[model samples]
Target: MRKPLQHIWALPVLAAGLAVPATAPAQSIDVTLVNGHPSIFLWVKHLTETFIPAVNTALEGTDYAINWSEAYGGSLAAVGGELEAVEVGLAEVAAIPTVFMPTQLPLQNVSYNTPFGPSDPRLVMESVAMLHDTVPGVEESWHEYDAEYLGGGFALDNYVLMTNFPVTSIEDLEGRRIAAPGPAVNWLEGTGAVGVSGNLTTYYNDIQTGVFDGVIVFPTAAAPARLHEVAPYVTITDFGAQYAGTLVANRTWFADQPEAVQNALRDAAAAYTEAYLVEQTDRVAAAMATIASDDDHLHVLAPEERTRWASALPDIAGVWAENANGMGLPGSEVLTAYIDALKAAGADLGRDWSQR
Candidate 1:
């Protein structure tokens, strides 16, 4: 009886409350992440494990979310095709292996051009990250390709030579067709080894079919690829780990995003770098152990021979820097800053690339 008295006015308020939508769920932004290589690669693996997860975590409780569509391993683009893919907006983001796109992203290959400086993955990563932050040319190079450089600066473990036969001296590499990825072919100059341009995906089949005599590759990758099965003789060349690639987003797509989304992408990239380094460190030791257990497969080149091999090489770094500078890029500054960073980190450099 009490409720029935003068309760007709309250019905409208109750109806209004019912009509209001329960705060609509956050709007989801769809982002496609493309990488030419399969997720088996450490860098690609962490895209799911660390980077994407970190971004999702950072955006939690926010009014924005990302629906990630991952296209990797030749699904969206073939190896070396990521640059063009992102440039044309085929994908929103990409893990671009700059080594593969040397012509377009020359500055990102500074570490590749300046090898034998440091074998520590962490140091290489930090130096490259620093270069990206401090060097305008580095960032500008990416912009030229219509992409914004995200923060994933990756370094592989130290490179080694996996050959069908043993390599005890520089003479052993004479006339040998050794496979090297992209610009790393430069590392073979004057070593008497013929460096064929090849990548991890094709090396195993190439070596097996006699396309090349051996491959200049790192342990973590070689182990999983099972290159040891075909190229059983492993020589620890100490060519040093290298910063090979980074995350990039389509410039237009990135510009259209909210500031929070932009920050989340960058923060996630940093997390990717750290996660990759940790995995690479642990995996390198484990891979070495796995190889060491098979004594017949693993051999460390004598330190003297390593130095001799390094000395036999031409001034590849100098030539590389000079060539880049000729093209109006700050190649020397990048080289100097990189070597300086390595030296500051107490790296036992095999050659003074900056001095040349």
Candidate 2:
């Protein structure tokens, strides 16, 4: 009877020991990503292809897993509504295009205000990332909107002019109407080209309807839009690649996340940046080739002509810095740091925006 009782106790103890090795299921965290534009765009595409997958992989074997919800193509917000969407907690993270939110993110628009710099997307992203990491004002600009900047992503290739007619010199653009997106209207300054505010979605129809004679755009985008069909002449103005926006997360939600989860989001952002640059760089040449093959009229503006176009522009950078300073943001400091970093990186700048 004593042996039987001991065996019964040992059986219960063995059962308890077996249960201890059964680990609890990982916690599931819900994260929603939003973008104003459709996922067809390269940056948005990477969110699904590169960034999200990277995050999932990083979180593997961890105690937490993310269940992602994606809102893109104006499903959650329009072209310029991403910043506000994230701020109000409509989404956990977003790709906020700084060009569209000039009033709210003036400091992040450093690349847009100062153009004709490096054409390489990789170099442009590096310079902007360095500023975000080093410049307190740059990061603070995002904080003001209740979000945190992760990393920068740039569109492919340098900006160019797509026109119905040929442009041999700066004088050619004089008195002609040109459609430029948002602040890019500044690029047409002093060129005599009448700058009309426009975007990619409307570029083709606008030019076809005679609303604007030409458009300032990059190859990767222009080719897909088939702008060459209406505006056959493409002048490589070398306006330089631009750091359009970044991956950002809502401040409140990001703060509440576990440390491991936070690291995964950031690490994934870094990977997204690298993957985007690689694709953007490769796509440039291919896009240019497709355009050249499709359109008979293609011109690479003379080096001297390019220089004149850049030099004739007014001190827009100075005006931008002044405006930012008035808003109590460190515009001048960031501008100086950005130009210096680009120079140190061996960027072939057409103008030293900071010096001016």
Which prediction has the highest lDDT against the true structure?
Answer: 1
The collision pairs in model 2 are none
Best model per TM-score: 1
Over 153-178, each residue of candidate 1 has an lDDT whose tens digit, in order, gives: 67888998889998877888899999
Worst 10 residues of 2 by lDDT: 289-298
lDDT of each: 0.86, 0.86
The residue-by-residue lDDT of candidate 2 on 177-198, one tens digit each, is 9998778899999999999887
Candidate 2 Cα RMSD (Å): 2.6
Q: Give TM-scores for every candidate, taking all chains together and pairing residue i with residue i.
A: 0.94, 0.92
Return the TM-score for candidate 2, rounded to 2 decimals.
0.92
